[model samples]
Target: MSLEHSGGENADSDLYRIRHSLAHVMAQAVLDMRPGSTLGFGPPIADGFYYDFVLSEALNEDDFPEIERRMRRILKQGQRFYREELGADEALARIDEMGEPYKREYAQELLSREDLDGLSFYRNGSFLDMCEGPHVDTTRDIPRDAFKLRSVAGAYWRGDSDNVMMTRIYAWAFDTREALDAHVTAFELAQERDHKKLGRELDIFHLDELVGRGLPLWLPNGAVLREELEKLAKELEFRAGYERVATPHLARADLYRKSGHLPYYADDMFPMMELREAGDDGEAVKEAYVLRPMNCPHHHSIFAARPRSYRELPLRLAEYGHVYRFEESGAVSGLLRVRGMCMNDAHIYCTEEQIRSEFKGVMQMYAEAYAAFGLSDYRVRLSRWDPEDGKRREKYVDNPEAWEYCEGIVAEVLDDMEVDYVDGPGEAAFYGPKIDILCRTVTGREEQLGTVQLDFAQPGRLGLVYVGADGAEHTPYCIHRAPLSTHERMAAFLIEHFGGAFPTWLAPVQVRVITVSDQFDEYGHAVVDRLRRRFVRAEIAARSDTVSKKIREGTTRKIPNLLIIGEREQADGTVTLRRYGIRRQQTLPLDEFEAWIAEQIASRALP
Candidate 1:
């Protein structure tokens, strides 16, 4: 249900084997039921496993009960998994004889693409599949009550849109039934707190097809969330000695080329636009431009714009820059993955000698911001390049010395800070190593919310230099940090984190003043105006509705505070206050209430 699988642990664990073996068992059961169903791929996922099939009959959830029963029956037989190795041609022949055309085709493609000694197949009972697996020794090893079929959906064969769509059966598997039940409960809760659903119900943001996919238009309320987050980031950055700067949304293609993003990250970028203009010599000059995928290049250009001295070391430049990425349509989901985003990005140009303190300062800022947001369930990951990887040169900067130097600096700082972090080999950026802040969502899925990367190559490549105390120019190490990530991702996290009931300071409407009746309308307006003057984001609900209805509406809208004004409240200089998710209601003097709410807002109190 809520299984947390690290990349390394999940690959070879016994749980993985159970899930893998279960996939084959499920496949056999499906084939037994349908009689003519052909299989594609069946691989274990984080929580469970799924198999793709070209079914002769259309299948739905209604048919799952029978399929699951058959799976249990097969599991009770205690079938032993036997592994066999055969030549590629023999494997293809066997697959063809089994009448699995997709498997035969995949085997052929693999044989052509890879240099292999032979192909391996695993046979459990009468079911045979082409898989390189370390499956459970026997069907008895899989818990009978710990797995269940979850849902059915269409998935393209081989994940290619041009290929035929196959029916995919998803299932959940765990070591124990209790784990499965816990995961199911968490999953149900996650569905209720889904950001996409809350975003619509709360009127925060909208994704319109006319505007294109993965591009969200923030409604008024959603814009308020974004602005509040920006305000918070600016305040923190200012105190941290970060200078705010504005960068254009698009820059010349040459800028990205110099930053090494073009050759390495071109696929994720929009196509370049070429422009031609007449030069002073009457010759046509051609230039290419692209939407900025990141703010680092622009910041680098700023650092290179003028000569710098060591006194200006750690020249921190920050921006809430708008960036665009060419995310695939299928990959984009709600605000978590989008084509357009506003990044809380910054670059610190510091000398090699100052890299430790500068990097530590960024981490401190991240900790402080997380504390303010009440985010404690997160882990730091030290992502590094795998020197042993065969294509390390192609995947990372091809300078081992620079890689060692920068990675050592990062590791030393993290060690000195005594931060607990996991090593993520082969997860580094193309240019350098990075520290990723991975936050676990309510559903138990891990999401990367923030990152800080150390770059030793980009500055030299971009011609960024500062005069050293020795009076000679030297390259400054560039530290790229984004504690709050992007506006979209952060808002999505917060939406689910708080279940749309944001704290007072972050709520779009902090308070709603509702009149008990027409007689209290004037008083409600006065209270709202007073609150508004204090910048409390207060509004008045003076419609001819009942007091209960108005309060219910305000509660449903997730207003953190609701003020009810009646004859008594108007007669005295007092107001009745209702707080979201709180049962008690208190009536206090208007001035006293204002002071308390102001303190809450000022402190950014979390509920």
Candidate 2:
């Protein structure tokens, strides 16, 4: 993980220096405890710092307290941190004298590969290591009560699996004890709301070794969540003048090459499959196909299938297209990162003058969908290309003029809509610039949940054109958008956002009818039938358990509404209702309860 400050301080701030200095101090303490241990890399990370070491002995969680105590003693020594600069040969000699093989190897590699003029080393008391100097002047700058060693794990040297495994010691650091405590509490809450754990408990989705990693099998309940989301997307897209379309999951390799995704995105796509077919002359012909990693190319093919006129300018094609990607084994995690996903994807083919209006409509649709989901903690980012990058031709389409014009158009739209967005230089898509919607997860990390990319290269490459009113062929601009993202990612987000207790409409099991005793089983089934006829996802809990036990079970499953079918309620054609996360209960006529629930679901009311 990238380093992040616990107090929201940047790397050049005082808190960062303190954290960096603490890492060195911790290294000093560890070296004192294990005399022959050699250090690798010690860097400050999110919330704290960690030091990697090739230890002479094994370490475990049991040793954290003693190591922390030694660290505190070193902090009290008030050792001054001194920096020294040396040439390449001098640095290598110093590393050799220090008897650290990893440091010497890394120094040599840096000198040979990066061609650095020199190297810098820092020293505190008798301990010295090769590092750039931004450390605190003295060890006393670290607060004793604000930091604690978190855990020890094995990490490959320099994060390369081919290298030797080293012991990594992690610690949590903050500017104050209160901030550290608050972080601890929030971390615990995040663990409690972790999707993997809740997914199994709620029976939402599952991962099996046989089915393959990163491919989730959505259980019955999980399918409900997905279908409901797709229903919402279809309704919104239909009202916005979008025409739904379907495409195959795989396509010919030449298709991607034509769309400029082959050389740039080949590594992330699955291996190509070759087939032999009979040619027109009865000879064997070879063909190749691969699983598509995106839906835009296929949509472009649809747009180019027939000749078009200027009247069909802003043709919007939407699809829940299933795409496959070859994610690294280590990068695949639950539903967040997956190999197979059904993207809520679409492409808008519009003229140059119509680009702004079409793009603004997409943004407005996103706002409407987010408002319906009650999602407010998100920011819009204008990810632009960098012209000064050394490998600009390889990283981006080297069209400076098109890049400038498209980026200006997107910025103008955001300005006209009064949307607050931050500029993200060097983060644009390879084809062109894009607008990214980043939402903050419950764990305090921002994730890119949706995107709208302006493409100026693909349509021309794919030969997509329309006849203008002047009777000339003109290239149209394509806007690739996904407001709801993929079902897997959105479901994961909603699972965490609502803590698995979704609102009435989105809940997997909307209502459960519990019979007070086996005698009330008939009434429970009748009530469930009535609710199901009204299109509510209702079930009958007709077990021979007590009323209180049945109610507890329904609540545990996170059923939003529970209807009690007892003798008194059955006799009067009424039902006692209990809502999840609420303490009060009420008795109402069965017809009245049905009407109230239908309205609640129709309005998509939140708890």
Q: What is the C-alpha lDDT of each candidate?
A: 0.89, 0.89
Question: For candidate 1, lDDT tens digit of each residue in 433-508?
Answer: 9999998766667889999999888898888899999999999998999999999999999998889999999999
- Candidate 2: clashing pairs of residues: none
Error of 2 at 247 (Å): 1.3
Q: Relative to the unseen true structure, what is the Cα RMSD of model 2?
A: 4.3
**TM-score for predicted model 1 compared with the true structure:** 0.85
Write one digit per residue (lDDT tens) for candidate 2, span 1-607.
1233333557787778888888888889888888999988887777888889999888888988888898888889989999999999899999999999999888888889877988999999988989875888888888888898888989999777889999999888887888889978888898777778788999999999999989999999999999999998999899989999999999999999888898888889999887878778775638889899999999999999999998998999999999999999988988888999999999999999999999999999899888878988889999999988675557888889999999999999999999999999988998889999998766667889989999998899889999999999999999999999999999988888888888999999999998888788888888989999999999988778888898888988888999988899989999999999988999999999999999988888878
In model 2, the Cα lDDT at residue 355 comes to: 95
lDDT of 1 at 349: 96
